[model samples]
Target: MNPILQTTINKAKTIPISEERKAILQEFIQYIQQKVDAGKTVNLNFICTHNSRRSQFSQIWAQTAADLNGIEAACFSGGVEVTEFNERAVNSIKRAGFRVTKNGLENPKYFIFHSDDSEPIVAFSKIFDDSANAPTGFAAIMTCSHADENCPFIPGAEARIPVRYEDPKAFDGTPEESEKYDERSLQIASEMFYVFSKIKK
Candidate 1:
């Protein structure tokens, strides 16, 4: 692992998850545990309105956490509509210690790396059911309430898990922009670490 990412994981492991949140996370925990016990592949698709911030962070951190725990899982992120992955969110993720590489112009692709041995997660803004994603048998983790309520149905998801996060877009272009973005990224990272940490072989 990159030393910075190892540090972030160490810090995330120490962050406390509230009982209320844990109650909700337990549902996801049970689902993942059952899948792992069945020897089934676990796929999670994080969704938000724009795929710009929250969903991206959730997908990246969830995959990282799963990797840290030696859990075999694939993570993806998408939105209701296409938009470029916000640069601010990308910066925040980089600050949280992932190495990132960019490609393209209009809707550039981001390859986010957490560890040297794992393949980089390819991320960009697109609809939830984009051809890049698995058509079925994946969890649809709603990372923002709007996408959850509006989408009504996710074509092939086996589970629709609501794990909403406050949009850091609200803080964009402000003096606290960087701070808020980093805070949101760390918050998602902590929760993902909490979720994956519950898994037992």
Candidate 2:
């Protein structure tokens, strides 16, 4: 693992998760465990309205957590509508120690690297069922209330888990913009670490 990302994970391991949040995250843990027990590959698709922030954070952190825990899982993020991954969110990921590189113009794709040995996570905004994502037998992790409510059905999802997060976009243009984005990123990273930590494998 990258030393910086390892340090970030060490910090995230200590962040507290509320009892209510644990209850919600437990569902995700169980889902992954079931797949692991069955010797099946785990596929997780984090979903949000714009796929610009929360969903992106969830996907990246979840994959990193799974990798750290020696679990095999494919993580992806998408939205109800296409919009580039928010720059603020991308910066927050960089602050968390992931090396990121941007490509393309409008709705640019981001290559996020947590470790030099692992393949970079190619991230961008697209519909939940975009061709790049798994077509079936994946968990649909709803990362925002809007997308959860609006997307009544996610075709091909074997499980639909709602794990909503507050929008740091609300603080955009405010003095606390960066702080809020970092806070949300850390919160998601901590919870994802917690989820993977529970796996017996």
Stretches > 4 Å off in candidate 2: none
lDDT (C-alpha) at residue 144 in model 2? 96
lDDT of 1 by residue, 1-201 (tens): 778878887887788889988987887888889889999878999999999999999989999889878899989989999998999999988887888999999999999998887799999999999988888999999989899899999999999989988999999889999999988888888999899989988
lDDT per residue, candidate 2, 14-59, as tens digits?
A: 9989999999999999999999999988999999999999999999
Error in Å for residue 109 of model 2: 0.8
Which lDDT values do the candidates have, in the order given? 0.90, 0.94
Between which residue pairs do clashes occur in model 1? none
Structural RMSD, model 1: 0.9
The candidate that wins on lDDT is: 2
All candidates' TM-scores?
Answer: 0.97, 0.98
